[model samples]
Target chain A: MTLKLKLHTKPEVPLEADCICPDRMQSLNMTEIGDLVTYHGNRQVPLKNFFECSGEFDGEIDIEGDLVNVKHIGSTMSFGKITVSGNVGVHIGAAMSGGEIIVEGDASDWVGPEMYGGRITIKGNAGHMVGSGYRGSTVGMQGGEIIVHGNVKNETGHVMRRGLIVVAGNSGDFTGVNMLAGTIIVLGEMGIRTGAGMRRGSIICQTKSELLPTFTRSCDYLPLFLRHYFKHLESLGLIISDSLINSPFERWCGDSIELNRGEILLYAGK
Target chain B: MKIKSTTIVDTFAEAFNMYVSRVIITADSKEWAIAAAQSITGFATSVIGCKCEAGIETIIDPNDSPDLRPGVSVLIFAMDAESLGKRLIERIGQCVMTCPTTACYNGLAGGSPVIVGGKLRYFGDGHQISKVIDGLKLWRIPVMDGEFLVDDRFNIQEAVGGGNLLILGKDQKVTLKAASAATKAMGKLTDIILPFPNGVVRSGSKVGSKYKKMIASTNDAYCPTLRGVVEKSELDDGINSVLEIVVDGLTLKAVENAMRVGLMAAIKPGIKKISAGNYGGGLGQHHIHLLKLGF
Candidate 1:
C-alpha cells in the first residue's frame, strides 16, 4: 500500500512539508499522517489543511498535484522512493542519504542540495543550482546522482565534493564552480566560466564552450572512463550518440589559481 | 560404459580446492585484446612449477564487455586467496598494463576482493586518477598511448582445479587427434578452462620420484615405453600412446560438465579407453566419478 498525497487546496503561500518523506511517514496511520505539522508560510498548519492524504506507507509515496508551493518534500529522507506527478518547489530531496525521487515535471531551485546519497531525476527543466551546496557550505552533493533531462540554470554542482550530476540539455553559467571533487557532465551547450575555481574534479561537455583563463588546454585524447559513464547514462534512457562515445576530447586542466588539478573534457568530434 | 570403440574407465578424477580470479582484458580491437590475454596467461601452466594455472576462458563481444570494447576473459587459479591476489597484480601490471590499447577489469560480480589496480596505480608516479561508477572504482594511469584503465579490486573465489582425463589410443597421431577434438568441444563451455599446451599434456607425473630433490616423477604405469618393464602397467595390449587433459574451473559442477563433454567428444574409432587420474581418492576435495557423470 503506497502512501498517496494529492493537493486538494493550493496553498496561498509556500508550504514546508518535510513530513511527507517516507522515513517520517512509514509508521504513521492515515489520520496521524494527516495531522502532521506543516508550515504554511510563517504559520503552522496541519497537512490535512492543504493536501488530502490516503493509503498506507509501504516504502513508496506517490504525490499528485501542481505542488508548486510545496518545499522540503522528502528532505533528509534516508530510504524509500517518492514520485511527483507535477511541478515541485525548491529544496526537494535536500540532504537525502538514500532512496530515489523522480519528478515528472519541472523543479525549482536547489534540487538535492548537499545530498549525501540517493538519486534525483528531473524529467523537465530545472531552476538554478540543480545540485549545489547551501550558503557558506563547503561541500555540495557529497554522493548520489542528479540527472536532469532538460536545461538547468546557473551554479549547478557548486562546491560539489562527490557524486555525479548529468544534464542532458543546456546549462547556465558557473557550472561546477568551486568543485572540490566530483563529476558533472553536460551533454548540451554550457555557459561561461565552467569549473571556475574547482580544485579537483572532472567537468565534461559535449559541445564547445568558452572556458575561463584559469584552465589550460592539455591534450586531445579519448577518455576511456567516460565510456562507462555514457553506458550508465544510456541505461537511464538518455540517447548517447556513437560518435560522441568514440570521439576524442580535448583535455583541459584548469583552476590554476587553486589546485590546478581539475580537468574539463570538451568533445572533439570525429 | 562404452561409447562406440572407447571404454569409460570406472574411476574418478581428483580435483582440489583452489582460489580463482577472472580478468577481463579489453582493447581497441579484438586482436589487441587477445594479444594482452595471451601475454598475461603466459608461463602459467601448472601450480606445481608456475605457482598458478591460467587459461583464456572466452572472447567477449564488444557489446557484452565492461567498456563496450572487444574483450578476452582469462581465469587464473592459485593455491590460496592471498597468492591469487598477488599473481593478479603481478601479471596484470606486467602484461596487460604494458600492452597497447588495453584495459583490465574484474569479471566476477562478487567474491573476496583483492586490490589489483590500487597497487598498480603507483606506476603512474602520482599522475594516476581514480573514478567510481556504479559503486565500482577504476584507476586510470597515464600511459604513452593514452591511459591504462584497471579495476581497483578483483574478486577471487574458491574453485576446483587439477581435474584430469587420460586418453589411450593406438598411436600418437590418433591420440593427439582425439585430444584436440575433445578440447575443442570443451572450449565452448563457460567457467572452465583447459590449462595445458593446446589442452593436452603428455608428461603425466606421479606423486613421488626416485631422486631425493624431485617431488614428482613420470607415471610409469601409463607410459607405453615402460609397459613391458613395469609390472603394474595400466595400458592394454594395443594402447601405444596416451595423453592427458587438465581442467580447472570456478565450480565443481563446471569441471564435471567439461569432463563429460570432453569424454563424449573423444570417443573415436582409434581411441582405446578413456580413464581419469587420481591418487586412490586420497588427495583433493572433490572426486568426479566417470561412471556417475550421467552419460
Candidate 2:
C-alpha cells in the first residue's frame, strides 16, 4: 500500500525537519512508512505523538497536514511526486535536486534554495529568498524553476547562478540583487534596486523598471531572438505567455563593478 | 483535364529528398523585412548550380512577428541535412545577425536538433542572458544597439529540391524576360521557393563531365550550339537561349504549383517550348514527365 504521513494536529516551537525534501524520499522503500517524526526536548521526537500514520512500504508517499509551523517540509526529493495540501514552513524545498513537489498553499522563506534541478510549485504566496543562496554564500539557484502565483518577499534571487523564477504578482525589494546569471521575471511593477550590482544574466520586467545607478542605459530596440524565445517558453507550459511578456522594451547594461555584461529590459512606455 | 485550351498533365510532378529550414527575419517595417529576406535568399536557385535553393515564404504582419514589427519567412533547402545546417548558420550569422533592426528565427520545427543561440551566445563575452518563456529558451546577446534576441534553437524538416523546368526562348533578351515573368508568377505560390540568382540560370548542367575527373557538365542536349552534335534537342528551330528555374518545396503539391505557375508564364511570346532535364529517369527515383504534363 502507498504510505501516508498525516499531521492530525498542530505543533509547537516551529518543528525543524532539515532533511525532509521530496526529492530524497521518492526512492525510499520504507517498510515503516508511517513513522511519526517530531521533536522532543531539543532533540527529534517520534511523529506518532501528534499525528496518525498508516499504510505499508511503497514508492509513493502522501504527506497530508497543516504544516504552517513545520519548517523544511520537503527540502530535496527525487523521483516521486509529493503533494502538500496546506501551507508550509521555511526552507520548504531547499537544495532540491529532482522529482516534483506541489505545495497547495503558501511557502515560507527560502523555498527551493540552491536547487540543482527539480520542479517546485506553490499555488500561493512564496516566502522571501525563493531561490537565493544561503546567507554569506555566493552561488544561488543553479537550475530548476519556481512558479509563485502570489506575492514574493524581498531578495528573491540574490547571486543566482542559473535557472528561471517567475512571479505572477508583486516582487518585493532587492529582487535579483547582484545576480551573477540566470533569469528572474516579474509580471508586476519592479521594486527599487532591481538587478543592483548584477554581473551577467537577464531580468525581464513586464512593468517599467526603477533602475539602479550602476547599470548604464543601453539603446532601445526590438530584440528579435527574445520573441522566439518567448514563443518556445510558452509551449513548455511555463508561466511565460505572449500577451504578458511579448512587448517592446528599453534596454540597459551595467553594474560595471564586475565589468558587467548582464541586461535589464524594462517594459516600453505606453 | 483542360482549362481554356491549356493542358493539365494527368501525370504528377515528382520531387527528390532534400533538407529544409525556415528563417524568419524581423525588421522595423515590412519594407526592410522584405529587403533583408531578399538579400539573404539571393544566389540560391538550385543545388546543381548555386549549391542551395531558397525563397521568401510569406509576409508576416507586424503584430504577428517578433519585435512587434514587420517580418517575412524565408525557406532555404540543401541536398542534405548537414549542408542545410551549415548554410543556415552562414546566412543567418552573416546577413540577418549583422543587419540592423533584424532578428533571425527558425521556421522548421524538428530535425537533428541543434542550438543556434547556444553557439552565438559567445558574442556576449559571458554576459549573455537566457530567458525561458512557455518552455522556449531565448538568448539575449549584448550588441552595440542594446541586445540581439535569438531563439536558442529552431526546428528543421525534410524537404525536396531540383523540382525544375527549362524554358527555350528565341534569344538572350527574350529568354531573360520569360524567366522573369515565370519567377513573378511562381512568387505567389507558398511552401515552395526558388533559390538562385534572380531565380534563373543560363548554365544548366547535365549529369556527368566529358573528362574522367568531373561529375557534372553543361546540358548539351538543351544547348543551342552543336545543334547537329546534340541529337535530341528539346529546343525548336528558332530557340536560341535556355534558362532553368529550380524549385524547393515542403511537399509534392508545393512543387507542382511552382511548376504550373512558372511554366505558364515562361510559355509567353519569346518562348518556343518548355521541358525538364532528367537522365532517362535515372538521376532520381521520382520523375516529372514534361510531355504528359503538357497534355
Measured with C-alpha atoms, the lDDT of residue B292 in candidate 2 is 47
Candidate 1 chain A has its poorest 10 consecutive residues by lDDT at: A49-58
Task: Locate the minimum summed-lDDT window of 10 residues in model 1 chain B.
Answer: B126-135
lDDT of 2 by residue, B234-262 (tens): 65678788888888888766776678788
lDDT of 2 by residue, A117-201 (tens): 7777888898889899999988989888777777898999888888878777888888888898887777776678888878887
Error of 2 at A94 (Å): 2.7
**Clash count, predicted structure 1:** 0
Flag clash pairs in model 1. none
Candidate number achieving the greatest DockQ relative to the actual structure: 1
lDDT digits (tens) for residues A14-90 of candidate 1:
99999989899988899999999999999999999988988889999999999989999999999999999999999
